[model samples]
Target: MKIGYARVSTGLQNLNLQEDSLKKFGCDKIFTDHISGAKSHRPGLESAIEFVRSGDTIVVWRLDRLGRNMEDLIRIVNQLNERGIAFYSLQENISMDKASSTGQLMFHLFAAFAEFERNLILERSAAGREAARARGRFGGRPEKLSNDDLRLIKTLADSGTPIKSIAERWEVSRTTIYRYLGKLN
Candidate 1:
């Protein structure tokens, strides 16, 4: 059996391209997800892995779609390899069962590149946060309550006033009050 896997990072992302490619390959089944690869809770990918069996082939548009990082890709590939399941990467034109030595080398090279890519992303994000902090913009969410309101809340709580009543008077939910109190704690 030939099974296909597809992934996109955002809910608004379209899956048509991957679906069309899988159909062209005559995949017996296809699993897809719009969840970011950084997250481990990809329902579609998990289901696809579970569905695979010995003698089955797993098809993917690219290796990166299989995981967010090198370790993840290697782990998943090892799992499939152990099961005697072949993998076919359409874009790379590589197959686990038939790959030449050079092909295998290139696959690992791609894994290294994926790791490099993730590191670059983290570096950029960290730099962005530092820049924001330098600009005196690093802080929690934009103010949801006025200073007076927060002071009133603190005072009410200090006086042994029930949090539920304070929340009611402030027109906020109990969860919101608790969240605010967490900052104080």
Candidate 2:
């Protein structure tokens, strides 16, 4: 039996194209979710996984329709293989089953490419951050209080001034004063 899974990013998007493809592919049943691929808790996908058994093949309109990313795609396909099931992507014309060495090789190559791409991205990001630091441009939110404000806060704290009073003067919360004074820690 071929079980089909389809997804759309939002309710505004229709599942017709995916459904039609799955139907044409002779899917015994089709499950769908009107949720983004980034979301983890897709009930329709969960149902499709639960409905399959040994000898069943899971089909999708495209690779992207089945997973949030490359990692997720590999994870799901590996799980299906472990369960004695197969996976097929209609648009990609790629199929994976326990019996196919070519399919397994292709899948492994895909995983390797995904990992290599991630490593390159990490390297580029680190270089970009280093270059930005060299230019005296730091990331993250700017400091809310200036050096003068910090000095005044420290002095007020040393003089045993009430936290609420100092906070009122600075127009910030007492928690902010406590945090700056290292009292919160």
Candidate 3:
């Protein structure tokens, strides 16, 4: 059996392209998720892994769909291999099965390349951050609330102002208010 898995980073992205490719590849069943690959918990991926048997194969439209990074990809592939299942990536032309030595070598080579690619990205990012720092700039999103806003929130809360009212005045959730206060603790 060839069980397929399809994923998109967000709900706004369509899964049709992946699903169609899987169907065209004659997948017996295809599980899907509309969530970021960085997330560890994916119901569809979990289901597909659990559904496969010793002789079954797992297929994905692309290698990245299986994992967010090389470590994750290698881990999931290793788990499948340990379970006596084959893995295939349609776009990457990677096939790893129990009886194929060439396939095993290729999988390792691909994993090495993936790792190198990740390292390159990290290096580039670090260089870019350093350049920004040299110019007195920083990355990341700016804070939503300023110190003054926080002080006002603290004052209101200390004066017995309702959390809901404070949240409304600050245009934030009560949870956010608690979180900011929690930071001081």
Candidate 4:
């Protein structure tokens, strides 16, 4: 069975080209996503993965259509190969069926490239975060409560204010109030 997967980065782009090629290749079923490949979670891709079985082939219009990066590509293809599935890319003209020596070599190369790409991304991200920290910036979400708010919350708790009442007043959970009070003491 041939299962086709098509993707477009945005809603503005059309899947017509990929769809036509997959259909021309005589795909039994085609799954599509109108979302960015950068997103790790894709419903169509997941569905296609889940739907396929051993001896099934997943066909894509191009290599990039299937993954956000080379690391992601290797992950997906390796997963399929481990399950006795094959992958076919129309534009690249590559078929990986776990039999051909060329296919095996290509896959090993993909693995190496994926590793290099992953490392480069990590290095860049770490450098960017360090630069941000140097400028008095930080990563992660901003705090829900400020230092002043925490002190006030402590004072309120000390004055015999009910936890539930304080929580209701600040639109925060009772656990939050408890946490602040505990930290203050």
Candidate 5:
């Protein structure tokens, strides 16, 4: 049996094209999801995986329709393989069953390229951060309390003002006050 999976990023997107392709490809049953691929929990995909048997094959309209990223794609393919199932991507024309050596090679090559791409992205990100830091810029939210606020806080704390009262006046938590005082010391 061939089980098909179709997905659209949002509820507004149509699933017709993917469904038609899957049906034409001879899918016995098709499961569909109308959610972002980045989301980890997809009920339709889970059901399709659970519904497959040992001799079953899973088909998708495109490789991206099945997974959000390369890592996810590799994981899904590995899971299908472990369950004695085959995976076929219609647009890519790749099949991962025992008979297709070319398909297996292409799958591995794609996985490797995906990993390489991820590493390059990480490296570029680190470099960008370093460049920003060199210009005295930093990431994350700006400080909520100004230098004047810090001075007032330190003075009030020194005068033995109640921590809760200080926090309430500043519209902040007691922990925030403590953290500021710690930084002062």
Candidate 6:
């Protein structure tokens, strides 16, 4: 079986291109996610990883889509390798099973580069945060829900309104309502 995995960092990014690429590669199963590669709680990717068995192959639109860090990429690849599952990257024309010694070397090189990129990003973000703190401007946006909103959330929740519906009506996420409810109770 040939399974494909595609992911985007956020909902704003389109998945159609990755999906089309996977389909063109003749993938029998495709899992898609709108979560960042840096995140560990990607349900779609986890599901795809768990779905594969021995003799199965996992196809990806690109190597970076699998993980942003080398350790994560290597861990995932090692897991698949342990299960005798091959990995194919459509863009890189990389098939672990078909890779030559040179190709294998290049794969490790790319993983190192990916790890370096992630480290650079983290370093830049930390620098930016430090600069902002020096200026006393390192806080998040003010909450959209005011005290009135919290009261309304509690009122609706107490009246047996579903948190999902209340969130929709209030133009807020269920998480926000739950946070306020947690504080209230």
Among these predicted structures, which one has the highest TM-score? 5
Against the correct fold, how does model 5 do in TM-score? 0.80
The best candidate by lDDT is 4
Predict model 2's lDDT versus the native: 0.90
Q: Which lDDT tens digits does candidate 4 get at residues 18-102?
A: 9999999989999999999999999999999999999999999999999888888999999999999999999999898776788
- Residue pairs with backbone overlap in model 5: none
lDDT score for residue 144 of model 6: 81
Superposed by TM-score, candidate 5 places the C-alpha of residue 44 at a distance from the truth, in angstroms, of 2.8
lDDT of 5 at 86: 89
Against the true structure, what is each candidate's TM-score?
0.56, 0.76, 0.62, 0.69, 0.80, 0.56
lDDT of every model, 2 decimals: 0.83, 0.90, 0.90, 0.92, 0.91, 0.85
Q: Given candidate 6, what's the lDDT at residue 19? A: 98
> In model 5, how large is the Cα lDDT of residue 17?
95
What lDDT does model 3 reach?
Answer: 0.90
Residue 185 in candidate 3 has what lDDT?
A: 61
Between which residue pairs do clashes occur in model 2?
A: none
Model 1 vs. true fold: TM: 0.56
lDDT string for model 2 (103-139, tens) is 7887788789779878988999999999999999999
| All-Cα superposition RMSD per candidate | 6.6, 3.6, 7.8, 4.1, 2.9, 11.4
Off by over 4 Å in 4: 129-185
lDDT of 4 at 86: 93
Q: Compute the lDDT of residue 62 as modeled in candidate 2.
A: 97
Q: Tell me the tens digit of each residue's lDDT in model 3 across 1-185.
A: 99999999987899999999999999999999998998999999999999999989999999999988887888888889889999999998889874699768866876797789889999999999999999989878887788888888888889999999999988889998999978756
Per-residue CA lDDT of model 5 for 102-127, tens digit only, reads: 76786688779789978998999999
